[model samples]
Target: MKAVRLEEIEQLFLREVERPVPGPDDLLVRVEASGICGTDRHLLHGEFPSTPPVTLGHEFSGIVEAVGSAVLGFRPGMRVTGDPNIVCGHCVHCHAGRINLCQNLRAIGIHRDGALADYVIVPQKQAHELPLSLKPDYGAFCEPLACCLHGIDVAGIKAGSSVVVLGGGVIGLLTVQLARLAGATRVVLVTRQASKRRLAEEIGATASFDPTAGDAAAGIAGPDGLLPGGADVVIECAGVAETMEEMPRLARPGGTLVVLGVMAKGEKIQIEPFDILFRELRILGSFINPFVHRRAADLIISGAIKVEPLITRRVSLEEVPEVIRNPARPGEVKVLFMPSA
Candidate 1:
């Protein structure tokens, strides 16, 4: 089996490795499609915590090549997506139903061998079924969509509510669609990329904004601006310092601000605490998919959320290392690795 291994920080390579076998409650998944995420880059640079000498693909889906004896509902031929994050059930957070915040958390790609190879082992509890009839590439999106769904759950979007998504990447685009589905009538997408802005509007954004053109704050919340008095909810998905600073300003007084972006560890950004205090704003941070993976799978299987447009291109497993080594290409939403390509 060929796997892309993060040997250590700043050291990544594609090498041949022995195939893995499933344990009593695990499934051996033959890698089909895996999405390259920004976190992969962060992990390569040691910006995010991860166990090195491991495969680094968390967003993936594949056909079950084999199943453990203890596995119940799944068979060898089933198509499934893995919830990479594994939690210790006895942890305080997990016992309280907050698995995402588990004190002893181990993620599939980050902590162990993942789906970036010919075979990866998934605990039966982490496997979510996907329809065989669905597009193979789309299944990989279930992981990201699950995380976005968690953000939507945190934002508490309502009918006729206004939302501002502060990035045009896959997460932002997915968040835009979910906001609309959550009944937000005025969904605004802000990004510097012209193409992503257009795509956001096509998908669900009622309008789009170019933050580089002019004062983004004034243009979006000015008296004659799109939202006029700011939006009911502002979700920061860019994960950049600039966008993080602009998030609170984009939300109306007494409105909500949800941070779904993953900023680099030890990074610093300037924000005004007085504004949040004066406006009585509600701010929250949304982590990974807690209990939303099943719903994400359902949405993808039912075609409720459009993912075909978010896929930029596909590459072979041989190309995975270089793709992770370099920065993402301009306007590239999602670049997937087809293991069998």
Candidate 2:
């Protein structure tokens, strides 16, 4: 089997490896589609914690080629999406139903061999069934969409609420759609990319802003701006220093600010604590998908959250190492690797 291995920090390659076998409660999925994520780049640079000498794809879906003897309610022909984050059920957080914050956490792609190869093993608990009639590429989006759903849950969006999404990447775009579905009437997407801004508007954003054109704060929240008094909720999805610094300023007094982005470890950003104190703002940091994988799968399967537009490119596994070695291409939203291609 061919897998994209992160041999070590700053060392990645497409290597031939032995195929994996399923455990008693695991499913051996033949990799169909896997999406390249920003975290993959972060892992490559050692900016994010990951176990090296492992396959590097977490957002993926595939056909079940084989199933363990202990598995039930699933067969070898089922199409499924794998939840990469596996938690220790005995952890304090898990006992409290906060599995994402499990004290002992091991994630596929990050901590174990993942779906970047010809075959990857998924425990029965983490695999969600998808209709065989669904598009293979779309299934790859379930993991990321699940994470975005968690962010939306944390943001607590309501009917007629206003939202400002900072970033036009896949996460940001997905957030925009979820905000609208949550009944937010005013959704503004802020990004420097003109193409992404246009796409955001077309998808669900009531309006879009380019930070490079003028003062983003004033343009979005200033007098006569889109949201004259700031948005009811501001979600930072860029995972960059500039957006992280500007997140609080985009929220109205007493409104909420949710950080859905993943900044590199040890990175520093300047934020005003006094401003948060004065506004009495609600701030939150949303981690990976905790309990929202099923909902994300349902949304995608129902065609409610449009993902076809978010897919920018589809490449073979051979092209994945280079894609992760560098930054995303201009205006690229989501790129998937077709393992069988």
Q: How do the predictions measure up, each by TM-score?
A: 0.99, 0.99
Residues forming the 10-long window of minimal summed lDDT in candidate 1:
111-120
- The most accurate candidate by lDDT is 2
What TM-score does candidate 1 reach? Answer: 0.99
Q: What is each predicted model's overall lDDT from 0 to 1?
A: 0.93, 0.94
lDDT of 2 by residue, 1-341 (tens): 89999999999999999999899999999989999999999999999998888899999999999999999988989999999999999988999999999999999999999887888999999999999999999999999999999999998999999999999999999999999999999999999999999999999999999999988889999998999989999999999999999988888999999999999999999988999999999989999999999999999999999999999989898999999998999999999999655
After superposition, which runs of candidate 2 have C-alpha atoms over 4 Å from their true positions?
none
lDDT by residue for model 1 (1-341), tens:
89999999999999899899899999999988999999999999999999888998999899999988899999998999999999999989999999999999999889998877778899999999998999889999999999999999999999999999999999999999999999999999999999999999989999999998898889999898999999999999989999999988888999999999999999999988899999999999999999999999999999999999999999998999999999988999999999656
User: Can you give the lDDT of residue 176 in candidate 1?
Assistant: 98
Report the Cα RMSD per candidate. 0.8, 0.7
